[model samples]
Target: MHISAREREIINLLLDHPDGINVQEIAESLNVSSRTVQRELKGVESIASAHSLFLKKVLGVGMYIEGTPEQKNELQIAILKSGQEFTQKERQELILCSLLKEPESIKLSSLANDLHVTVATVSNDLNKVEEWLKDFDLNLIRKKGYGIALLGSERKKRKALGHLIAQQLNEYEFLSVVEDEYESKTRFSNGLLEIIKLEKLTMIGKMIRDIEQQLPYSLADSAFMTFTIHLSLAIERIIQGEVIQIDQEVLEELSISKEFIIASQIVIELEEVFQVNIPIAEKGYITMHLLGARQRQEKNDWQKESSTEMVVGSKKLINYVSKELEINFEEDQALFEGLITHIEPAIYRIQKKLDANNPLAGQIQEDYPAMFKIIQEGLSEAFPKIVFPTEEIAYLVLHFGSSQVIYDNSKEVRALVLCSSGIGSSKMLASRIKKEIKEITEIEVSSLANLRNIQIDQYDIILSTVEMPGFSKKYITVNPLLPKKEAEQIRDEIKRNSLTTEATLLRKLHNKKFKKQIKLKTPKLIKQNLEVIQQYTETVLHILNTFETISLPFIPTSSILLLEVCKQANVRGLIGDYFEVTNQLTEREKKGGLGIPGTSIALYHCRSEYVMQPVFLSFLLHEPMVVKAMDHSSIKINTLLLLLAPVDMQTGQLEVLSTISSTIIDDEESTRIFTSNNYTDIYSKLSYALYDNLQKRFKD
Candidate 1:
């Protein structure tokens, strides 16, 4: 009962065309097999009979509903009374039966493969088909390895076919209309041969005789013959439940019809039947044949227009022309505008020249050498040109080039800044003004005392900390001594000059920041950052350890001593020295009036490794130390110690200091381990935690 989407599509296509579709055609349309179409139809038959619907088959034409006209009428009335309640698949199957003139038996294997199902399923469908036809003394006749056929009395078959036809007419009125149109068109044609090809040879002879009587002069011309062949092929495909693609243009041209209404109608019908929209142009020239109004081919004449008249000026016009010619153009504003203005008139003039009757007009190289050169240059610059009428050329040029002219409506002003001395103060003021007030019209800063020496007409607003003589009162004045509030006031004035300028700039800035943030978060960017940091640190470490001994800065008198402790044991020489300095610094720093004791200081040489790798160390003070000089009371003596090492170090003693800093600054457990003298244990614990944190944060 539940049909797949593919089965539904196939059923719809079949239902679209009445009079019976061939099994092979159905297979082809559904991209399966004739056998598959048969099996699916059988399944449909079962479902229908289960619901008291009749399915019947014709001897040669195809299958239909088996019932008398009155019975068919009754079925139709019942279906209407029931409001046509059916699933999409059921509806599709009904439609197919209505469209098809004949339904044929096909092999179960072929059907199974086409439907992508097991042969057992096909057998089950056959059983249902037999059950559906039981009331009419009809049943599915299976031949070994051949296929299954409907076996029933001719009267029963006719009645069933009538029932199907009536039902189809009720559901889709368009099917009858389409068939009528097709019959009208092919009534006198020999194309019926194509439709009868799949039938038995004995039937073909009878069909030929019937065709001859009906269409005596249909084969008189090759066009009619071709139409017959194609139409018959199409009918055969439809009967077989296959979707067919007929060349719309070819059909129209072959028929010698100027209008393609018939072809369009066919497309619409097919679309409705199959529920698939085919990609095709709505309008196009059919080149298969030349007939009537289409017989006259326009000649491409070059000497009909003036050169200048052909020029295109406007970007919009250029774009229109380019689109017509399927060409690409640059989308930049300035370049496009310039191209439109400068080239439009020239093209128009050229068009005019080309349109002249004189033969010389077409010879651009001889008659208008300069114009020809310009065209060549434009072509090289990727501009497109088409051989169109002079008027069209002129229009295109004007359209593409009209936007090039720049309009100036705002007043222009140049202002100068005056200060006592043109040094730090004046420079600072200029920088501040530039940064804050972007719209000052024009700006000039100078300490030159004589304002009358320069052109006074250019000056608008004079800003000076000192007094200036001979200044016009009409000009605005502001102090040169820059203050945040004064800068803000000037900014406000600039904002008033242009309402949207600041907002636009801010939007642009925000957009840029957003783009940068996106780039920063990319995996590639993070990897690159890590690589650069590692490289820089390694290089600095190499330099500091291998070369350069440097003296430390003299400790200032105001320096707060941090540590003072007796050296307990002899450590590694450099390490011992570092410890002594750190201990003393920690004691001295704690001695200040501020109450805190756990603080410690660490020192290292300046080197790449030390600088690149941050230093973190942790230790708990034995007794609480106080530094009264400091202010905050939240500071506690029992705390973690951290030290930042320089990029260059004289002694290699700072190596361990690097890892210590990295640890204590990040996780809490590092401080615990450092206080416990369990460096290795602390490293293990922190490393595991770090790995877990990174995995959780960075998993894809």
Candidate 2:
């Protein structure tokens, strides 16, 4: 009988470890809970017995496979070829995954018949699948008479394929790390699971830990996952005797590098575990990846050994980059200082055939196309002798990108509004600040009389209507009414003070979080870290299910858009019209426009007394409607979602509600709100995934 992928891995691990390995050791290496290792132990023995072996376990000593080397190798070979069969959900995911990962286009009818579903159902499923494609800057295009194919960048395609494989082995962070309430996880594959196997993934995970120990830094989670997948693929090829060959010169160069040394160390462990001979040139492969993986800067320690040559390089790079982009960075001292610190270590790694690895290079290219393209072309000219890896190049792009932003608004900006004249003026000023500034998260108004009692240190900026000439603090003086010109003046003043910018704030926050300048509120600096929290929660409030979506005649104006969704939700008994949800949504629109920047989707959400329970309401226009965005740019909005929750709910509870809706409308999530031709498919794909993710996140 073919064993499950996970059980196969446990068996292989036991076989490799003749001296025996403990449950905890196995769990740590695999990045799984010890409880999972224990559960799999029961099945390992039964499978081992079939091959004339015993998976013997001692209470304190650990577990081992008792058999001759010949029997062990025979069992290992059988397990290598064996793999778990796909479930119905997995088959559907596999169909979609193959279309994206494979080079050739696939027929819709073929996929439907293979998955034992009708063509119509498969067609509907493609809608939800297409949503995932959008996130990678890819399009899942279907030719009328031909077949469907995923079109995008090669790197993005690989990343998507990596994610698909990760999902299959139940290695997904949401499914594995989180204690989700769901009975089963939906999985995907690209016809490689039987070849790659879960055992390889566990070994890959161990390999990553080993590499990390030798480095001065750590890779981002996405970067780490990408590396894990790369290593797994390498091992799979090794098993098939498809070893990679590196040029003699390149191999010699990489052999002396620290990254290659680490890679060599990893190979020793891998060779022992898998009992396969890894090619000598495989070290170069790992070395190249080490250079390609993105690095998150943990400190300014590079500043300590500040070398003059590095400073010169940073200056030349900054100058050429500024000229190429037609921007001013000559006088940005901190930018100079940061670049110098970045370059010293970067060059040290690059010279040794390794460069900093950045997993979000694709995102940087997508979001800042011009910047990335310009930097890519001009970097060689900027630093004549340097051969920068793609990851290092992207890192440089980030430095220049941050330098050009209007101002740094990274922290939760707090503004104390003071009016010497009256309380009303201060309140009015605070309201105008809220309307004008998206960056300022908190506003506190106080009269000059009570200003002494209010802690000035707590505030990032002090905005006063009446200037106190003798005031010892830096404050921006604004008109009481806070007109557009006056608001612009305040913004310019804030920009002039570069320390108050988002870049500066983020750097400070990152240091604090990393060094534990503040207490650790999380199990690790992941999921709950500032970057991660925002990353996951950015598209939280969106449409949830097909029932939540209502088709509308082409919306003409913002006023009508608000009325229709509230009315639709109210009619369905999902909400009641105190028009409080409507009023808040309209208020949001008036602040700017209803349209989300950079997309045709408009999101309107609020917590209101009018809300009975949490409800997600979506409206899609029959034809696109032009609406205003925050920047006053006209956006053709095709989709809109209204998320309403009870006013008294906790922020975490609100996040759960947002995440549920997001699973539907979010372009990244599996369950889509707008794509399915038949609405009922949304209920099945969404109802469980949405609830399950929420439960898992909450438990963690």
Best by lDDT: 2
- What is candidate 1's CA lDDT for residue 95? 24
Q: What would the TM-score be for candidate 1 when compared with the true structure?
A: 0.19
Candidate lDDT scores, in order, read 0.38, 0.62
lDDT by residue (tens digit), candidate 1, 301-361: 2213213333332444445433432233435355454443334333433432211111122
TM-score of each: 0.19, 0.37
Against the true structure, candidate 2 reaches a TM-score of 0.37
